[model samples]
Target: MKAFIVYCHPSENSFTRHIRDAFIQGVTDAGHECVISDLYRMDFQADMTEAEYLRDAHYRTTPDVAADVRAEQEKINASDAIVFIYPVFWSEAPAKLVGWFDRVWSYGFAYGDRTMKTLNKGLILCSAGNPIDYLEETGILDSMKKVMLGDRLTGRVKQAEFVVFDSTSRENPLREENWDKNLKAVYEKGKSLFAAK
Candidate 1:
């Protein structure tokens, strides 16, 4: 299987980057192909232009999709699965990633008269500053899942999963304690992503 990873992180000096690397290594080790879009490195334009907003809002199917969005759509079509790696901010994915969905999931592509492929899997691996229990207790985790899996990824993939590596705040002592364990889990997830299918 080929996995297209959409990695969104502002800096390389972060745990999210390490998680991304480990996941890729496991994927390659498992004899699967992996393609990556390092959004920050690529300086991808996430904000939608007025024309793009108009096109989507008006439900126009014309080939007016921007080059960048078209390129992202092409990547999805060319892959067997899609993976997203990022850090959760304010109980949500970073603004950049949110904007990515806004533009890339165009009306004629991800919805309406769709041209996008329904992939085998869609996986979201995000890091959070709070503990899992806290996130769960506050219903933040469920909300995140609902948005990512229940909404954005709905009907777009055969199966989808939302996994968060929590208690990752720099000030948290558990951050160092769980670092290796978290990476191991993500790596294993990448390795076994396509095992069932």
Candidate 2:
């Protein structure tokens, strides 16, 4: 299987980076090919220009889409699965990723007369500062899943999942305590990414 990983993070000195690496390691170990888009490293333009917005707003596919967005769409069509790795901010994905959806999921590509392929899987792995119980209790986890899986990835992938490693705040002792365990789980997720299908 080929997995296109969209990783968003501002720094390498983060557990999120380690999770991404571990997931990649497991993917390779499973004998699968993977492509990555390090949004921050690539300095991906998340915000759409006025022209781009107008094109989408008007549902015009006449003017060619931006080369960068086209490239991202191409990647989606080429891959069998898509994985998003990032941190949860304000109960949502980082603004850059939010922008990624705004731009990459262009009107014609991700919707109307879409050329985008329906992939085998779509997975989201995000870290949160709050504990899992708290997130669940507050319905934040469900909301996140609904937004990512029910909305963004809906109809785009055959299967989808949202996993969050919580209690990862720098101030939380569980952050250090669960580091290895969390990474192991991430690796296992990668190794088993294609197992169900």
Compose the digit string of candidate 1's lDDT tens values, residues 1-197.
Answer: 89999999999999999999999998999999999998989888989998888888899977578888889999999999999999998998888889999999999899998999999999999999999999999999999999999999999999999999999999999999999999999999989988975
Tens digits of per-residue lDDT for model 2 on 41-108? 99999999999999999998868899999999999999999999999999999999999999999988
lDDT for 56 in candidate 2 is: 91
Candidate 1 colliding pairs: none
The per-model lDDT (C-alpha) reads 0.94, 0.95
Q: How does model 1 score by TM-score?
A: 0.98
Identify the candidate with maximal lDDT: 2
Backbone collisions counted per model: 0, 0
lDDT of 2 at 23: 98
